[model samples]
Target: MGKRVLITGSNRGIGKKLVEQFAQNGFNIVACARKKDDSFDDYLKDIVRMYNIDVTTSYFDMEDEQCIKRELKSVINKVKTVDVLINNAGYGQNALFPMISSNELKKEMQINYISPIIISQIVSRVMIRNGGGSIINIASVSGIRNEQGRLAYGSSKAALIFATKTMSLELAPNNVRVNSVSPGFIDTDMWNNRSEQIYKKVLSETPLGRQGNTKDVADLVYYLASDAASYITGQNIVVDGGRMI
Candidate 1:
């Protein structure tokens, strides 16, 4: 398809995999990151050359609310309009409830919850003007689970999931779909940093008996962005191998 996708956190594991997946499927890409990475940028460049796809890489700090809007405006200026938007840029938190500081909690909410909403507000307007689009939020399993730790990060993602529902309802009339994907124990750099005991517990709980991969999440997003999933909206589709159950 010739449609374009705007994916934040493009330098990270899942984000990078999502870029290539959409590119291979012939979707023009707009890759957004908090900062510039030479190696990652070079990788995106190679993707453009090999896939013969249009790719735009943008750099801006998600912590800055104004910058979030400004950068997305810049993207719209260049791409004209984005058909799909993925808010995948988020920092994980491992602090227990009492251990989490107010500053840390606010930071997590700003980057993970507030920032995605701000970006969605901008892009949803564009989508409405351009006849509609899809918005996929990459949330986490901790958001819905009553797990130890994850006080800051889990609350932030919980806010995102709620927004996904509200947005889907409001934007449905405009044909803009909004949904979230919550992945559990996904094997990425983020997971690499987890304590061995934590990893073992999650693996044991996962019905699939294995950690998830980026493709598992990407495939669901791609479908939601496609016509096949035209009737789906306001759904938080978990991709954690029944871990939530």
Candidate 2:
């Protein structure tokens, strides 16, 4: 059997691709997402067939604190001693600063930053008991820099980056390594829905001359989860194709 890993928001986008990649590499996957209907059952079944790995699905809504606590407590044993935990459930904030409400900002923080922190606390205890584990936080390039209309989204990821570094220091003594993967504009559903003007602007500034695909992020995540990254922690690796330059 391979190492067990729990990844949130694995129903679609980069998160979904991560699940597939890890499972193919023989890792047991605990893939969580919001409650799904029958329509999505086929998706999970397809992945199960393709990977030949155990993929456990759980209902998690980050906006609800009670849901997070309850879900984590119930599955604590399954995730306890797990090899890795990927925090990947976040959204984009497209509203301008003046138009964005305080409530919206708070919700963004709740989903993008606060929930991941809470989940990590629960999982890290399990890792400690099991001797050690790895944690890979899925952050964004926006976290490291500023954006015009991404006040809430960017700030939430920024908070996550800080939490990742601090937790790495706190968990290092216990042998648990924590790191982050900050991706550039990836080809996901969100990117597909981005306005043409916004997309063009992003592409123009990106040094790679093209946007990234979900596999690009997933591949990097797989590498970080391996033993090759054992000595690396408290670092935010930017997978932006030199976009920041």
Candidate 3:
């Protein structure tokens, strides 16, 4: 009986945490991922058993346009309406521009920027039919500030931020709201995978003196997707633990 939400890349990290938070709030979740395994299966089983919320999993590959189309089709066919859509499937790349390969740059953009666009377009149709919905895009602080080695990732997030703003305007007439959550120095696998030197440097600069946790981002995202944010749209909220300032 809860509102249905379709969250991309929900198998791990911030996306996974978001799934848990939303489920706690009594939301029916369509947790989409690029693949499936025991870990995610167990996670979903536990969430469903514990929260008693309706939960389904879908397979999605952002880089493959065909895969995006197929997954969207399957979701729409399965769920009559998607009350909330979270564009959170993206990748991060850090390296000097000259040192980064063109293919790598393209892959970053495809996952971080293009993939969201495709998913939004497909999902927005379902929202349009549902009369209204909320779109929460997971962006990054790099979207607002330039960093030493985040050339590709930063640029892609910047585009996503812009997309959230513009999509809000276009979807508002149909009663849909679009917004973004930009987190800085989140303590997710993305950060853990970075070199120790880079991580240390980032931590040294953060005013909070620590990295953020996935739950931090998940909480904010869940709030934005709720009825409490009914009047909010076209905004990029920075949840960076004051790292930007």
TM-score of each: 0.97, 0.95, 0.96
Clashes of each: 0, 0, 0
RMSD of model 3, in Å?
1.3
lDDT (Cα, tens digit) per residue for candidate 1, span 156-206? 999999999999999999999999999877878888798899899888999
User: Which sections of candidate 3 miss by over 4 Å?
Assistant: none
Q: Over 4 Å off in model 2, which ranges?
A: 78-80
| Deviation of model 2 at 33, angstroms | 0.5
Worst 10-residue stretch by lDDT in candidate 3?
89-98
Give the C-alpha lDDT of model 1.
0.90
Taking all chains together, the TM-score of candidate 2 against the true structure is: 0.95
Question: How do these models rank on TM-score, best leading?
Answer: 1, 3, 2
- Residues 1-245 of candidate 3 have per-residue lDDT tens digits of 67999999898888989899889989999999998878899989999999999888889678899988987898789878899999998897778977999898899899999989888998899989979999999998888998888999999999999999999999999999999999888888888898899899889988888888998898889888888999999999998778788
lDDT of each: 0.90, 0.87, 0.90
| Greater-TM-score candidate between 1 and 3 | 1
